[model samples]
Target: MIPPLLSRTILATTLSVIFALPAAAHFQEIIPSADVLPEGGDVTLDLVFTHPFEGGPTMAMKRPVEVGILANGTKTNLTDKLVEQSDKGAVTWRVSYNLPEPGAAIFYVTPQPYWEPAENKYIVHYAKVIVDSFASGEGWDEMVGLPVEIQPLTRPTGLWTGNLFSGVVTKAGKPVPFAEIEVEYVNDSGIKAPNDAYITQVLKADVNGTFNYVMPASGWWGFAALVEGDKPMKSPDGKEVPVEEGALIWIHTSPMGK
Candidate 1:
């Protein structure tokens, strides 16, 4: 038999050591093994930890971690960094890669579970994804709801109106002007054909988040603006620009002086 106070002290110390560390370690999983590479499009990659909400603290060995995507063994780092699940003690790292054209790419993360007591920090994770060019109508416009205003142009062919439009993209009721706007026109058939039905003119908003584009010719047009985001926003043709929600304004050109 031991003294009562000593017995209580020993029991408390044992409990502290037992609950000090994670019960088990985990690895990450890759999803959508194959992804469509939009012409000049940006791709987002998600690295999911087998453990939930293990973003930082929940990782093994408390190591410095990095996640990246690979193309033919060439690696590209993702920007999303790491995220943790507070409730479940799981973690995830999200990353983005730019795909110039359709091809194959591999992805992985490094230096995970970088702590001591070796048994807990046992898993290193990596994976791959298939990239291919996507057909039309399978891009950001499709991913997010495209606002279609499709307004008519006010001028004739090749005539510069010196007229400009003013507006700003807003989220949560705040103006967001740091974006790119493109005026796109559809063919007479009302369908943007793969060959020659789609026409576009790219422009940028002013300091006040305003723009003035002299309507050149018109069928149907809209404003494509870049919104606030983590990864760089890209056009269908793959031009890197600010990302933002867009508005579609219809334009019908008159025969000049109208």
Candidate 2:
């Protein structure tokens, strides 16, 4: 009869084999159904296998591997990572990350090889994700709405030490070069955070309707970029040149707002 300790060791080895089979199979992909993700929301990236080891004779009897989410540049490992099992031979892994700014996020899945490195090896594949602006809203009309382009030129966020407000102005459709710009203050209601409050700054587009200007104040500010030509070449009652659609306006309020 086999000793009890020997039997227990065999059982443990069997379980490990079952779980390590999938990793040995080949390369896979985990995550991001759509390229563009809604900003500031829970992001769930699904894990899927691919070439090097999709479903085929190469695949082993047991399938298990590691998956993870890479936000901005940080690596969040999620392999062999355990989750409550609802049924048999099933597993799930999930994580959440907050993206405050608009930009791209990347994810990768690394398949681990169970066998020796010389004979078989594991690899990883990457996927790109884009986080859209939070300011977008139902009220925002593509044909005509407030401009969302707001960027710093020289002095990025702080007390006003000098005179110079410089930044590029881009509308939804095309870049607004030398656009007629204006600055003002709007009450902040959306973002409760003082730093995110709406402050106003007006900028005039350059010869191409792109705007680059400066503000004298250090408080929060906002801006409105209108496409009306310089000097309104036509009389008010005369044929009115239509204002281009996708005109943009940006609003910001600093902590100093009263």
Candidate 3:
């Protein structure tokens, strides 16, 4: 006969495997060193896949399918300049761009499809961030022509912490009705969540596909609008699964002076 304690341990391990879950929100982050620049110069960016609120257990990122910056009415390709960085057995990416002249730099990345065994599907998050240079205040409304993207109703930069952010979720150039958006604040390395569900807040767009969220804290915040793709992708085990298409946008807000 087996000891009761040994029996309990086996049961717990079996349950854990049976219902494996993702610990935090999976965000494809294209974060820059600074969101606003007083003067124009060079800026560095890090492309990572991780739970921003938890800081990370960084997920591996393959070379992105497309990467560029839309500025001065032109899109400049920066894929060749990407540098891969590895941490704790996971890989990420980095790049540096010369922010010449005064204007808005909208950097975007279309990451290669990432397969999640837990969800049993592939995820492709089209992520972007805006940097205001020299307070140029131009091109904040620029669009990247991605398959899925967010059109910011409010100016994407120079925002206050409590200001409301609103944007439309569009796929293939048409607005989606009642889209689902997931929100998360970049945890700045040490913010603790009260519970598992608290790590990622969920919201929905209105009938016109426009969504709003009030900035709750001062720092970088990411909004991801997820939808299903028309096509399905094959999994490693040879099963065809639906593809998750996400349109993600990032913005930074400042707190009032103390």
Candidate 4:
């Protein structure tokens, strides 16, 4: 048994460490069942707002403002097809799309502004992911023209685990110099982070708004380039609050194996 004063001191120290730990970054996930459809069949997409590395405490998401697919220079609205899902009391969404043609399908989502009380602001993440159908090499680099977007310098799909993924952070079709990007892998393999710093990797783009990262593991990785919204929005409390605008892109990698 420990003395009362010493025990109290230890408790205070433990609490301080816990409070100082960095919070896991939130990623707007638009993960498809398969990034490459060999025969151009149906692919289901799971849209969840959560900390991908931690893989828990999924945040509630309202019905998205827009959901669409851009393929072959054509954009089709899929917002009406979203099916609501719930995970541990948090609202999520899913949709299935058929890709009959041989081309790259760019799926994007504009989520409803989420009010985060802890940050005293609203978050609107414009997220997108590319799915190549029938191994079509064409149209892999088409821009969706989102307000905030990532233009891939390297092809977004058909990547090996060690391949370096590079892109430019753009806002309204213009490069955003020195943008900050947060990266997290979908921790499907139950990989534990040694500490808070390993949970999310953060990096800044170059003067040309370009950034790159090598995927060390085989899984879906999300890159979110964060910036402030052009204007503040009304919060749930009726207060004007700044918005954290994130241009997010997800890519998948596979190991070289039999």
Candidate 5:
């Protein structure tokens, strides 16, 4: 019923608006089979680069540049232990680690630079997660000395669903004032977001580079503090592109059962 010229114009506008909408935030996930090892045994870790909230279209991750675990004041390199995993043609990584002692094992990964054509930039997320072994409650705050990292103000593990998680966004061991952090939950329960806005929660750090968020659900929550890299990197097409450095940390929360 509409004029052909006007109809074409409207269709073009609609398509443009849809494409203009921001894509779901990319989270570098370092999920473990268990966050706490009450008895202290082997723990399996899955490393994937994906949109945790939307839950799919996982990006292919090359073998990490570095992977290690810090425990009992010692850092052990585990890069050679990584085994490649594939899902629907996307490459991921997995590692199995044994926790024989009682302490917090902080595992971290420095992934290869990923090129994002949509943003015309490269992404490098330094991600880490803690596995408390035997509930020792010790060494939970040890710094991995990553170039960019989230220094937890609160203990990073064994939390209730409604507990508050707070941390400081630091780059090169110094606070980054008012840093932007993106939070997302790993969608294991098939929960749906009512709108696109709910897919990723955004918050800014305080003047001291501290941020707080109370997770409403019980699952693995990831907080990524995004900051521009100090230097540019060569893109796949040989262009000099800026890098988006994300200091990411993941924590698990359990539901308070009746």
Candidate 6:
């Protein structure tokens, strides 16, 4: 038996360690400085792998395997433009693009399979976001033809904080019924979660793979719908590891009041 005071101290320390780490809800963010392009239709994008709600404890992201844009029914390879950066001692990527014409510019990335020690598997999030410029929003709904993607039913731009954002979860070019989606608000500052459960909100797609969520605050909110890839990939140790294919969409919601 141990002394009562010492035993209570040990238990308190153990519980702190247990509750310190929030559940693993990693998000691959393709966040643009501005959702809609300004006069010259120019915007810079920040790409990172991390728990967005916590704004920290970032994970390593390799240089994307593929990075490009699909606009006006044409796909342009922008892989050479990515500039690597570091934050919180983790590697991330960024790029700057100036839209030449006024069409719905859909920027996307296909990152190399990342081996996550926490999950014990490889993760690949095919992330994308739309930046509308010069009032050209007609083609914002076009699909990128990815293995997993979220097709926005609502225009991905010009959204208010409390607005309802909806999208269809598609896997392999088809709707994924009852898919699992995790929501996280980018905790830049001011906004916070009191507990781990409040950090990430989980939702299930309807029969048609559609899901919606209302933004609680004015900031960037990331939606990631996870699905198992059709094929498995090998881990760092050469053992066959399962793959998690995520369809991620990041949108910015503006403040509705002072």
Instruction: Give the alpha carbon lDDT tens digit for every residue of 66-122 in model 3.
Output: 889999889999999999898568888999998978989999999999998978889
Model 5 ranges with Cα > 4 A deviation: 1-11
lDDT of 4 by residue, 163-229 (tens): 9999999999999999999999999999988988898999999999999999999999999999999
Each model's TM-score? 0.30, 0.28, 0.91, 0.94, 0.95, 0.91
| Model 6 per-residue lDDT at 83 | 97
Per-residue lDDT, model 4, residue 139, is: 91
Q: lDDT of each structure?
A: 0.40, 0.36, 0.91, 0.95, 0.95, 0.89
Top-TM-score candidate index: 5
Error of 5 at 47 (Å): 0.3
Better of 1 and 3 by lDDT: 3
**Arranged by lDDT, best first:** 5, 4, 3, 6, 1, 2
- Tens digits of lDDT, candidate 1, 139-246: 111111112111212221122334444444433334445456655443333443353223445577656565556544433233445344334444444655443223
Question: In candidate 3, how many clashes are counted?
Answer: 0
| lDDT for each residue of candidate 6 in 1-258, tens digit (9 for 90 to 100) | 999999999999999998786678889999998887755467899899998888878988889999999999999889999999998999999999988788788999999998887778889999999888776666899899989999999998888889999999998889999999999888887565676789899999999999999887888999999999888888888888889999999888888765
- Show model 6 residue runs off by greater than 4 Å: 1-21
Q: How many clashes (backbone atoms < 3 Å, residues ≥3 apart in a chain or on different chains) does model 2 have?
A: 35
Candidate 3 wrong stretches, greater than 4 Å: 1-23
Candidate 6, residue 93: lDDT = 95
Clashing pairs in 5: none
lDDT of 4 at 207: 96
Clash count, predicted structure 1:
32
